[model samples]
Target: MPRCIPIKEIKNTTEFARIVEESPEPVIVTRNGREAFAAMSIELLDAMRMERARAELYRLLDEAEEASRDGRVVDARDSIKRTRDRYGL
Candidate 1:
């Protein structure tokens, strides 16, 4: 579960840094009982980013599969040729 910290707590930089470094879960900083921001380990951030990227990749692949099933795809060679011509490659 996420840990909620009041904005005032962050004033103690050493303690706040230690809390963030030691915890595996996200630390949610709140301002006046309202959520302000979140702090997490670099590893967690990278994992989240990778998860989002994979989700996007799967979504694109699904779209491609549906298009292929609908016979909306062109020949690979023709597509490559068009790209080459467009980019003067």
Candidate 2:
């Protein structure tokens, strides 16, 4: 389960930074007995971002494979030439 703390407990910048850096899981900050926000380590955020990017890459590859199987594909050399011309590269 996530660790939760009342918003009032975060009295200062030092405590807030300490909570975010030291918590193994996201720290759920509550206000008025209700969920307010979440704070987590930068490492955790970076890992989440990387995972999202990897998932997107896999999805794109799957789409490309499906398109290739359906013969909705272009020649690599021709595609590269078109890209280069389009970008004036």
Candidate 3:
């Protein structure tokens, strides 16, 4: 079950950090009986970022495939040389 905590109970900003450290579960903060904010650890944030990146990559690959079907293309040799020069590789 999702953990829920009130905003008033939070003594200060650092206290919230302590609560987050002790529990990995996401905490939902409420105010005036309404949902207010959410908190998660860095692990959760990193996982979310990785998931978003993977989704974006997949979408780009799909677009690339569609573009190639329509005859849009890039030169492999030129692309590789540009990459090497840009990165000093």
Candidate 4:
């Protein structure tokens, strides 16, 4: 479960920093009884970003595989030459 904190409690930067650093879960900041923001450690944020990126990469790979199976594929050498000619590379 996430740790919930009122916006008012954020005024104490030291305590807020400590909570974010020590807690394994994200700190949910509420405004007027509704969730408004989330605070998490840098490591957690980076890991989440990397995981999302990996998932996206896998999705793209799957899409490419389906395209290849459907005969909507290109030769790597031909594609590279076309790209080079288009870009004057």
Give all TM-scores, in the order shown: 0.85, 0.83, 0.68, 0.85
Weakest 10 consecutive residues of candidate 2 by summed lDDT: 15-24
Evaluate residue 8 in candidate 3 and report its C-alpha lDDT on the 0 to 100 scale: 90
Off by over 4 Å in 1: 85-89
Off by over 4 Å in 2: 81-89
Error of 3 at 56 (Å): 0.7
- lDDT tens readout by residue for model 1, 16-80: 98898777888999999999999988877888899999999999999999999999999999999
Worst 10 residues of 4 by lDDT: 18-27
Task: Point out the higher-scoring one by lDDT: 1 or 3.
Answer: 1
- lDDT order of candidates, top first: 4, 1, 2, 3
Question: Candidates' lDDT values, in order?
Answer: 0.94, 0.93, 0.86, 0.96
Name model 3 segments beyond 4 Å from true.
12-19, 22-25, 77-89
Q: After TM-score superposition, what is the CA distance of residue 59 in candidate 1 from its true location, in Å?
A: 0.3
| Candidate 3 local distance difference test against the native | 0.86
- The alpha-carbon RMSD values of the candidates against the true structure, listed in the order shown, are 1.7, 2.1, 4.5, 1.6
Which candidate do you rate higher for TM-score, 1 or 2?
1
